[model samples]
Target: MARLELENLTKHYGGQATVRGVTLDIPDGEFLVLLGPSGCGKTTTLRMIAGFIEPSGGSVRLGGQDITHRPPWRRNTGMVFQSYALFPHMTVAQNVAFGLEMRKIGRAEREARALEALRMVRLDGLADRLPRQMSGGQQQRVALARALAIRPDVLLLDEPLSNLDAKLREEVRIEIRQLQQQLGLTAIMVTHDQEEALTVADRLVVMAEGEIRQIGSQQDLYERPADRFVAGFVGRSTVITGQVREPGLFESAGGLRLRCQGATAPGAASLVLRPEAIHLDPPPDEHNRLEGEVTFASYLGPVLELHLRLSAEDRITVHLPNRGGAGLIRAGDRVSIGWPQDTGIVFAGTA
Candidate 1:
């Protein structure tokens, strides 16, 4: 295991900057995830760290050693690609032994190490089977074994679970996290899946347009977002616009009134509301009160989604739990809903 460091790392293509000056210091044996949407420069940044692409500026250091210009093989980092890049002609054991063979280990020792790695991923018996004969999950295990055979200092995964089905993806991700923790490996993964990042990453870096938006644990980013972009991107948020009349008082042009529960300043305010926090058919409260007509309702398994069209040209989405028909409300029902004083946050700006 080793600590990874990136200082002012940057990359440019022609005159456009793909990755800007992003700096981060990751501790040893930590799992860091780079999460963002498509074309967010996350993959480019990972390639720069892997030494596959040279950076335009800054440095990459592993365990206090400068390896900014080192070759990919010399960097002692293992990469698990999204495609599961394995030689189809070779058996699982042979493919796993290829790394050790490149390092010039003897045949007997290389075979032993390959078997050990296969055993770690619970694929020892399938060592002789070809990738075509195995399932997608099995092929993924073979790729993992190949990456771990030479025991590289760091492990890098690039969307290693995108191809699998929903259930299998969850299972494989859990196995990967467990294996990483058991081996005490320093791992960095690049992914756009929010749930996957929240599940496996010790910490996550949310990036946008080649810049870092926020870096923290999943709870920190989900509960206390840094800005409007972070709040909307991290979770489902309903933003209502209004102007603050007093410290906690806000009024909209269509006669919608709101009183937030914090030390807020008087300005244009955005009331950010989470779906699960709002209750239905409640009396008018001092904090928040609104009446709306349900335009649509979707019956999800565990929860029911209610799409409400409120006054003031505002819309609100509510998620109600389905505990023995607790969500027995239908469309076109004019209902009054109120939330607690702390259910919504008042950002002193409109979006």
Candidate 2:
């Protein structure tokens, strides 16, 4: 395990920068995720760290050692791609032992290590089977085991679970997290899936257009996003356009008054409220309430996601835990939705 750092890293393509200056520090044995939409430069940054791509500027360091110019094989970094890049002709044990074999490890030692790696992924009994003989989830486990067998200093995963079915993805995510923690390996993963990043990473770096928007714990990003992009990108958020009505109050374009508990640097701003924070009820003379009509509703098993359209303003979606409010709300229902002034966050409006 090693501490990784990216200092003022940048990459350019055809005269336009794809990865603008990015700087981050990942502590030893930490699980860090680079999350964003496609073409956000997350995978590019990972490739730079792996020496698959050279950066236009800045440096990459491992355990305080400069490794910006090292080749992928020389960097001692293990990588698992989205496609489980296993050898179809080889059995699981042979696939895992390939790396050790390349390093000229003794045959007996390589076999022993390969078995250990297979056991770590709970696939010891399947070592004799070829990759085609296994399911998608099983092939994924084999890919992971192969990466671990090399015992690299840092583990890099590029959307490792994107190919699996939903149930298998969840199961494999838990397994991967457990194995990383147990081995105390430093790991970095890149994914566009918000749930995967939130569930697997100790910290997340949200990026857009090659620039980092914010980096923090999952709870921190969800509860206190630095800006509108982070708020919308990290999870479901309702944006209310408003100017600072006063130090702690805001008036929406639709004439809805909201009290934002989270303070912002003084300026024209907007308030972003999480769906779970807003309460829906009949009209009440409350300090912060907005009346709206439910325009659409969908039951999401655990939660009912309702789209509420405020008079003359943008529609917002609110998620209600279906278990509690399953029979309470419906489409076209008149409702008052609002959060305490202090429950929402005020962010600077982009010019």
Candidate 3:
């Protein structure tokens, strides 16, 4: 496995910086994901690592060696693109063996390695089939196999599953994660899908406007976001604009008093309340309680998403599980909403 590092990586185009002074160390065999919205320079960073885009400044290192000046083929980094990039006329086995042929491997050995890679992706029996003969998911696996057949020092995937159907995407994601873990390969994936990054990445680097916003595990990012941007970006959150009443308390314009953890003195800030963290019922003396009306409700199979009108201009969404109880409420019902004193996260600024 190869450890990848980018030090002070900066890329500029037409006098504008795309990647600005980004530095990160991806440990050997770790599944790291670069996650952000489109045009956030994630793909550009990956291209730099693959030697497709030369950095205007800084260096790229692989396995403790400087590879910033190396060519794509010389860097020994295998890339699986979003489009799969398979040769239309080549069979699965032939596609997998293409890289080896370029490296001048003997026919007999190349075929054996190709078969091994095909079997690793569970495509051994389909080796004779052309790309058009296979399903989207199968063809993607062949693409992965082709990349692996080259025995790269590091594997890079650029949203490899984005082309598959929803159900197939889920299945293939799990398959890809398992394959990476089993092979102990150093893999870096670039994706904009938050759920996909959370589901598959060992660690994630969140970016915006070509800059690294934050880097952490999924739980860390979800539970303790660093800023308002991150709090609103990673998951569903109701940004409660309020004035800090004290160290742990804030009072909103809607007359709701929110008690949060890790809050400071009286000031302007936003409280991030997750749907699952808010409760419909609160006992007397509970600190974080509010009054609202159920404006709308949708009966999802697992949970009902309730849109509560807290005030003239503010609406909060709450997710309630479908279970045996008073059942789902209607639009006109007045309700009291509460969250645990420490459940909601307080951000020091507005969205």
Candidate 4:
């Protein structure tokens, strides 16, 4: 395990920029996730760390050593690619031992190490099986085993679970997380799946348009995001556009008013509302109460997600837990949705 550092990392193709002055520090043995939409340059950054893509500027450091200019094979970093990259003709054991064979280890030592790696991923029984004979999840484990077999200083995973079914993805992510923690491995995983990034990361770096938007713990990102992009990208957020009506109040253009408890910054602002914090049928005189009609409702087994329209352009989704609320609300139903004024965050600057 080793500390990973990215200092002012930037990349370019001709004159077109992809990653720009991105800097981050990952502690030893921590699982960090780079999360964003497509074209966010997360994969490009990971490749730079692995010596696949040379950075146009800045540096990559592992522990105390500079590795920005090292070639891919000499970096001693294990990478589990999106494609799995397993050999069709080789058995799982042979594939796992390939790196060792390249380093000229004895046949017996390579085979023993390969089996040990397979066992760590709980795939020892499938060591002799061909890649095509295995299930998607099994092949993924084989890829993981191959990466771990080399015992690299850091592990890089590029959307390792994207190809699996939903259930399988959940299962494999849990397994991968446990394995990483058990080995005390320093790891970086890149994914566009919000749920997966939130589930597996010790800290998340949310990126967009070639730069980092925000970086924090999962709860921090969810509860106190830095800006409009972080608030909207990390999770489902309802943004209400308004101008400061007073010290702690705001009035939308559509006439909907919100009493933001801690709002001191004036002028054009946006109020971020989280679905789970919303209250239905609260007291009429409560702070931040809005009267609206339910426009859409969907039962999601565990919660009912309802979209309420305060006006044509001012709408919000409220997630009500399935605590007997399913029968109480429906589309076209008139309801008063309210929440604690402090529950909503007032973000200055509206776009």
Best by TM-score: 4
lDDT of 3 by residue, 224-314 (tens): 7877777788998888788788898777766666677788867888888889888778887777777888989778778888899988756
Candidate 4 C-alpha lDDT tens digits along 86-106: 999999999999999988999
Better of 1 and 2 by lDDT: 2
Better of 2 and 3 by TM-score: 3
Name the regions of candidate 3 deviating beyond 4 angstroms.
324-327
Q: Which segments of model 2 are wrong by more than 4 Å? A: 262-268, 282-286
Question: How far off is residue 170 in model 2, in Å?
Answer: 0.3
Q: What is each predicted model's overall lDDT from 0 to 1?
A: 0.87, 0.88, 0.89, 0.90
Candidate 3 weakest ten by summed lDDT: 319-328
TM-score of 4: 0.97
Candidate closer to the true structure by lDDT (higher is better), 1 or 3: 3
lDDT of 4 at 275: 94
Model 1: per-residue Cα lDDT over 35-138, one tens digit each? 99978889998999899999999999988899999999888888888989889999999999999999999999999999999999999999999989999988
TM-score, cand. 2: 0.94
User: How many clashes show up in model 1?
Assistant: 0
Runs in model 4 lying further than 4 Å from the true structure? none
